[model samples]
Target: IKPPSTESVAVLQQVPIKPLTKPLTYPSLVSVVEFISFGRRKQLYAKCPTIRKLEERLPYHLERVEIETIGPGYIILKFDNFSVGPIGAYRNEISMWCPGKRVTRSTNLSLYEATEKFALYNLSRPGTTIKTLETKYTPKCILNCIPLTIENYVVDGNDRDKWIIRTTRPVKTLQTDFIIRHDTIKYAKEVTVTRPSHLPIRIHTDILSEWNCESITIERELTHVEVVDYCRKVSKRTDRPIRSVFKSGLGGYSTELFQMLSRELNAKKMELEGFFGNLIQCATIYINESTELSVLMMEPEIWIEVSTTPPSTVLQPIKPLTKPLTYPSLVSVVEFISFGRRKQLYAKCPTIRKLEERLPYHLERVEIRTRGSDYIILKFDNFSIGNFGSNNESNGKIAMWCSGKRVERSTGQSLHEATEKFALYNLSRPVTTIKALKTNRVLANETLIFLDTPKCILNCIPLTIENLIVTDFIIHTDILSEWNCGCITIEEELSYMEVVDYCRRVSKRDRPNRSVLKSGLSGYSTVLFKILSRELNARKIRMTVFGGNVLEFANIPINETTELDVLMIKPGVLKIKVCARRTAIDRAF
Candidate 1:
C-alpha cells in the first residue's frame, strides 16, 4: 500500500508477498507445553530474556524427559518422537533427528555453556510437573537449579548423592529405586518401593520399613520363615494392621493372609463391607473398633501392602509409557507436538511427511466442518485439530489444538489455509478408509454453514461409510455422482439442477437406501421427480413443490415409478424423502 497524491497519482511502492511475522513476545508464549523436543526446547529456553523468575510464568509439564550423556562430550534431550542432541561434541553444533529429517548445523550456543544455561532454565521452573524425569547423572546444575518447590519428583537408576527432594506440596506417591540417604519417602503421602536393593542400602531396616507415609508397598520374594519373622517385627512395630502378600504360598484361596493375621495378632475374622483382597476367599482381620488389614493375591505377583486405610486409596505414580520413555522411532512415536509446530513439520519436513503418507490411517468416522467462515475443525476418531484466526492481520495470533494442550501461535496462514494445509498433509498422505463421513456447517452443538469447506474432504470420502451427510456444504458435481453411500442427505448442493442430474445418475447403479433434498425441486419438481422416477424405478410419487399436496403428509406414489414423502415441517420449509422398500403407509405409526 502506498500514499496517493492528487497532483501525481502515487504508484504503489511494494506489495508484500507474505503476512508479517509475529514479534517475539514473552508474555504471549506462556503456554503449558506437553511435548518439547531436544532442539526446539533449547531454542525456546534460550529465548528467555533473563535467567531469573523462570517459574513465575512458564507452567509446563514435561511429561516424559530423558537427559542422556552417552558418549564423551555428547549430551541428548529425548522427548516425543525426536532427539535434540549429541550436541556438546562440537562447541557450535546441534543435531536433531525424526522419522523423515536429520539436520546438523553450526550455531552460537548449542554445544557448550549455552546448552548448560538452557538446562538451568528448565530446572528453575517451580511448582511445574515433570511426570517422569529420567537422568543418567544428577548434575550440579539440576540439583541447584530448583528456585521454588516442585509438586512431585521421581528418582531412577543409581545416584552418587542422595539429594533430598524439597517439595512444598504433598508428594502423592513416591517410587524410589534404592534412595538411601535422602528422606524422600517421608515427604510422600504414599510410597511403593521394591524393598531396597541387595547390599548396604538393604541393611537400613528403619529406612526400608519407614511407615511415615499413610500407605506403603514393599514387594519382594518371601519365604515361610521370613513371613513369620516379619510378622513378629510388625507386632512389635505397630498393631494398626500390616498386610503382606507373596505369590500363592497357600496354593489357593485369599484366606491365607486373613488366617495368619487372626493367629498372630489374635485378630478376629469379620465380614467387613468393601474390604480388600477377594472377599469371597478373603476374610477381614478386625482387630480394633476401626482398624483392619486386607490382602489380595493376583498370580505370580505378591499382594503385600501395609496401610492404615485400604490400599486402593493410595495414588499410584503414573509411569510414562515404556515405549515413549526410550528414544522412539518415527512410526512408534505419538506425534507429541504442538498445533503450530505440527503444521510446520508436516509442510517443511520431507522425511516425516513421506512416512506419514506411506502409512494407512485408521479412521472410524470423519467430520470436517466450518464455524461461520472464520473457524474450522477436522475431527477423526478420537483425535481432532481446530484452526482459528484472521490471516490478513499483520501480526495476528493463530490458535490451534492437535492432541495435547491447545497452543496459540502467530502464523502467516489464515484459518482456512491452515485447516486445509493440515488436512491435506495429514489426511492425503494416508490411505484413508472412513467408516462414515460428514461435512457440516455446524459442529460441537452449534449449527453453522460450510461456506468455506475445503475440497480435500469430499474428494476422498471413502465408500465404506454408511452415510454421507452433507449439510450446507458447497458440493461439486463430480463428487455427487461418485457417491454410492447407503444414505445421501444433502442441502446446499440440492439447489442446482446439475445435482439432480447427478442424483439421477448415481441412482441407476446403486439407489441410496434413502435420499433427502432440502431445495431445488420447487419449479422443476415435475421434471425432476419424473427424472428420479425414471432413474430409480422404485415407485412413482408426485412431489408438488413444498405444499400443494392434498394430505399434509402424503406417501404419494405418482405414475408408479418413485416412492416419495412430502413433509411440511413449517410455513417456509419443505422436505422430500425418497425411501426404497417402505412407503409412508408402511412407515406410519
Candidate 2:
C-alpha cells in the first residue's frame, strides 16, 4: 500500500491594527506586507497552496495580492490596491492567506496597512473599465470626468465624498505651458513571478540513483529542544531509547546529531591541517545569536571565496593646467589673459618692460632689503655655476649701483640668473619686508599701499609695478594719529543726490573756490576722501589740511592755460566721484 500523502495545513490569523484617525479614502489603495516565520519542522515548505479569502463584500475586491517565500522559514504577503471601480460606488473587503505546515508556528510580525493615493490624471487602461454608476449616486467635481476603471478610481466609494471636497478646496493656480508627469496605476490581475526555492538541499549522486539529504548539521552543539526532537524522531524510526551524553562539564549534547556531521567535521579538521589548507571554499553558514558564544569557542573556519583576478584599471587622459607653470622661485605677478588660450603681457612702463624681458631666465638666488620705511631693494646675485660670470675667471664685481650704494654684486654668474633673481624676489617679498619700511616720503612714492583699514594692510607693491598696485596717492603727516578712529564700519547714509549735485557745481564753476558744507557730514569720509584724493593725485595736485574743515588745494587750473590753487571741504563721498571728474569731454553729473 502507498504511504499516506502529506497534508498542507491552513493557519488563520487576525492581524491587529489601530483604528485610523480618519477612515481611509480613495483613489486610495490598501497594501498589506506580512512576514511569517516557520518553526523547526522537518518538512519541505512550498508556496502557499491555497489563497484563503479572509473578508469579502459581494465580488473579489482584492487585486494584485502577492506572496513571497523567504529563506526556508519566512513568507511575505503584499495585498492589492482597492481599485475595482469608482472609489465610492462599490464596496469590497480586505482578504488574504498563505500556506504553512501543521507543525509550523506562524506569526503576523511586521504586518503593516498603508493607504496609497493615486494620481487623478491617470485614466483607466484599455480593456479594463469601471462599473456603471447608479442614477441615484453621482460623483462631483473632477471625479465626474474620470473614466470608470480600476486605474482611474482612487478613493473608496464610502469615503470619496470627503476626498472630493478636499480636492476641490480652493487653492491658488497659475496658467503655464507646463504639465507634471505621474506614475499610472493599471487595473490588472495580480502578477505572480516564479521564484527558486530558498530551502537548502544536498544531493548525493553516485553510481546509483541520486537521493537528497534534508538536514545540514554544522560543527556546533545542539540545544535542548533540538536534542529532544532528534531523540523522538530516532526513537520512532529505530524503536530505541537513548539518553544524551554531555561532552563537557556543562550539561549538553555529548555528540553530533548525525554520524555524517562527525565525518564532515573531521574531514574539515584534516583539510585545515593538510597541504591544501590554503585552498578556499565558499559557503554561507546560518546560526542563532545565542549559539554565537559556543561557535566562537569551537573556532570554526569558513572560507569566503574572492575573485582571483584583479579588477580592470581605467586610464584617464591628463588635462593641461589653465595657468602658466612657475618654479618655486617665480611669483604669480600677473596672468596674461586673452579670448581663448593666447597669452600676452602688456608692458606699459619701463620697470615692467625690464622684468618681462628676463621672463625666459632662471634664478640662482635672491634677497630683499628694506630701505628706510618705504623702499624695498632687490639684491640679485648670479655667481653660481652655469651662469653669466661663472666661466670668466673675473672676481664677481658690483654690476649696478643706486644712490652711490653697492646695490647688485654678481659673483661670477650669468646675467640670466641675476635678472630672474631680481624679478622673482621683487614679486614674492613677505609682508614683513613692507612693514619694516618706515612711512616716509620716499616710501610713499616707491610703494602703493592698499589700506582697507588702519589694521588691515591689503598689499604693498612698487608704484611702478602696474600689475598689483592701486592707483591712489598719499599725503604724509607725522601727527593726526586718530584720523581713522571712530570710523564708520557700515555704509554712511550721506545723500547720494547731494554728492551728485556737488559734483555738478564743481564742474560748472570757472574757478571753484574753497567751499564747505557742515550740516550733511556722514561717516565713510576715509573712503570718500580716497576717491577725491585719487583724482588729485592723477593730476599731480596737492591738498593740505590744517585744522578745522580748512583744505588747501594747490595747482588747480580754471581753464586750459591759467592755473590757480583753491581749497574745498567735504569731497564727494564715494569712489565713483573719481570717475565723475569735473573736467571731462561729457558732463559727469
| Candidate whose lDDT is highest | 1
Query: Each candidate's lDDT (Cα)?
Result: 0.49, 0.25
Candidate 1 RMSD computed on C-alpha atoms after optimal superposition onto the true structure: 34.3
Runs in model 2 with CA error above 4 Å? 1-369, 373-465, 468-473, 476-574, 578-589
Q: What is the TM-score of each candidate against the true structure?
A: 0.35, 0.15
Give me the displacement of residue 489 in model 1, in angstroms: 68
Clashes of each: 12, 20
lDDT of 1: 0.49
lDDT, candidate 1, 1-589, per-residue tens: 7756744543333544677587536644444322344345444555764522443355455556666755445567655456667443455777666667676777676474444555676556655566555555444455666643434455555443444455555567666555364555554666555434463323234443444556555444444334434444443445333443322132222234544554455543444322211112233333233334444443223343343545664445787766634435665442533334445576688767765445555554577777665567787644566554334363645555554646566667676666677677666543445655677643312222344467655454333554455555555555655544433444332542563455455444344435544333344444544554555453443333322433244343432455555443322234555555354544331
Query: Candidate 2 — worst ten consecutive residues by lDDT sum?
Result: 207-216
Q: State, as a TM-score between 0 and 1, how close model 2 is to the true structure.
A: 0.15
Compared with the true structure, model 1 gives a TM-score of 0.35
